[model samples]
Target: MGCCSDFLQRAKPYVAMISLQFGYAGMNIISKVSLNHGMSHYVLVVYRHAFATLSIAPFALYFERNVWPRITFSIFVQIFVLGLLGPVIDQNFYYAGLKFTSPTFSCAMSNILPAMTFVMAVICRMEKVDLKKIRCQAKVVGTLVTVAGAMLMTLYKGPIMEMVWTKHVQPHRSSVPETTDSSDKDWLKGSIFLVIATLAWAALFVLQAVTLKQYSAQLSLTTLICFMGTLQAIAVTLVMEHKPSVWKIGWDMNLLAAAYAGIVTSSIAYYVQGLVMQSRGPVFASAFSPLMMIIVAIMDSFILAEKIYLGGVLGAVLIVVGLYSVLWGKYKENKDIKESKVMALPLAITCSEGNGHNMDLENEDRRERKPMA
Candidate 1:
């Protein structure tokens, strides 16, 4: 009974993370369907954040009312920028890209996020790199490999690989013309948009790390970011989409997409990921991202009858490999740091217990002693 309970405790984080990935996959597919049905990306962004803000606000108000810190000018500016990068820029561009391309492609391309974040961190001097260290070398190599995979996916759209279900399901053609030249151009454009969105997402993560120092109430911070993002997205939506009709959503996929993305992906995902990260660490949480890509690929083929290409398959493989390499390096680096700290404590205690002369003589004697055969 004890062993079974212990096993279940260990399995909880894995189960939660896997379920979270499935939720993300559902968001991508549903959002793609909504975009296909003439829902403007601009309007979608606004509504999504509005729902997110409403969902998160009550919890923030109730739980963080006592502990919430005073918002200063600098913190406000950071929060504003966070809102801009996340809701306004990231979601809009991501939705736009998904409109042009398939959900699987977008999800696969998003796996480059860690590589982009690493580069940005290096540029910001927030991360250190030592060529001599194998861990650093792995990270550098993995980033390069990830970039190569993205380039491959963008430049080469090899022959479409047919799936069993796709053979039976009629291809759901969109309003957009599928001429070879136009489709290729649209794919390139979508790839560029997805890349831009990923970069903004990475920047948001970096900025969020810095912002947390001043404002430590995470729920309140998330609520404020969502509220500010909602306002910003509304302004952008008004500017981009003049048609009031675009704002109208009923009991359909649009409403479902908005509600699911805002509530499940934005609010609940953040909370659940935080819980999992607390138990298994951030590496474990992020390690399952590629699983979402795979799930989306399968679901896209089955549901949307979307065509998959050989180049995309190959590229996704490379990205997954590179992602694991980077994660492994990070895990090793963290383990080494923890081990060093543990070793330092005992050494510090030993030095503190002995007089300086005695400690020095003991150290010399230990160094002078020969190993037994």
Candidate 2:
């Protein structure tokens, strides 16, 4: 009974992880489609958080009805940091990067989050280091390899001949034009921005992990953070779009995209991720993002009619390989820890018995050697 209960508990997080991946995958496609339809990244972010704030409010109110703690200065500070790191800096940089780069590139860059999170966690002393252990070594090496893969994906276009061959066979090639000088420059700029976005995202992960330690209610904390983020995003948007004409909201695909991002991606996806984090921990929960990248790439090709170049495919493969390496290393490390514990239990029991036998022998010897009093 206990084993079955434990199995179920473990399985819950895996399910939540899958749900978060699906939500993010859908978010990528929807955001790209919305952007193509002329949604300014700023306005989209504002609406995304606004809707997320609204969606989470009812749940927060109900779930946290009677016993909600009064907001303390520390809690306020934590929420402020969450607003700054995640919703503000992270999302702003992400959308800016997306504007300059392809969704595929952005997705590929996201694979670096785990490594960045690991590094930041180590720096913050949240994670222990054991360089002698294969698990730690693998994690360190795998993270570096993943970063290398992201760099390769961003910087190297490979030979034009390979791109030409792949494009000739791919169905979406008909829609996409051969690279032009202007577009190439745009792509380069976008790639660089995406890398920056990835780094910012990594920072957000570290902040979130730390914040979670303080705020026990993920739902309420997320809701409050999103509310604060929405306000910050709106303020930024208003300043950036000083002209009233630019602030006009239209009921089109862009609006739909914003709604999707807010309701589905931000609110639902974040909620699911938080649930998963509770069970799986940050490392396992994050390992699923690369899978979302693959899903997004395929959906983008079919739905958004985007071209898949050979370079993109190679980059995707490298990212996956690197991500798996890190995950596998972590898994092996966990297994070793469990095995060590199991082995130590018997040794501990044997030592206890040996001590008991020694005490018994000493008592017998003392009794036998007693004076005839």
- The digit string of per-residue lDDT tens for model 1 on 128-156 reads 78989998898788777876776676568
- Going through the candidates in order, what is the number of backbone clashes in each? 0, 1
lDDT of each: 0.80, 0.73
**Candidate 1 vs. true structure, TM-score:** 0.83
- List, residue by residue over 1-373, the lDDT tens digit for candidate 2: 9999989975776677767777778777667767766677878888889989999889989997775666889879878877776677778777766766667777777777777778777888866679898777877777777767666765676654233334545555332224898877876776667667667666666666666666767788779888898999888888887766555667877777778888887777666776666544566666667777777767766665556656667777776777777777767866777899999999999999999999999999999999998
**Lowest summed-lDDT stretch of 10 residues in model 2?**
169-178
* TM-score (all chains, Cα) for each model: 0.83, 0.81
lDDT of 2: 0.73
Off by over 4 Å in 2: 1-5, 156-182, 333-373
Candidate 1 stretches with Cα past 4 Å from truth are: 1-19, 157-171, 174-177, 180-185, 271-290, 355-373
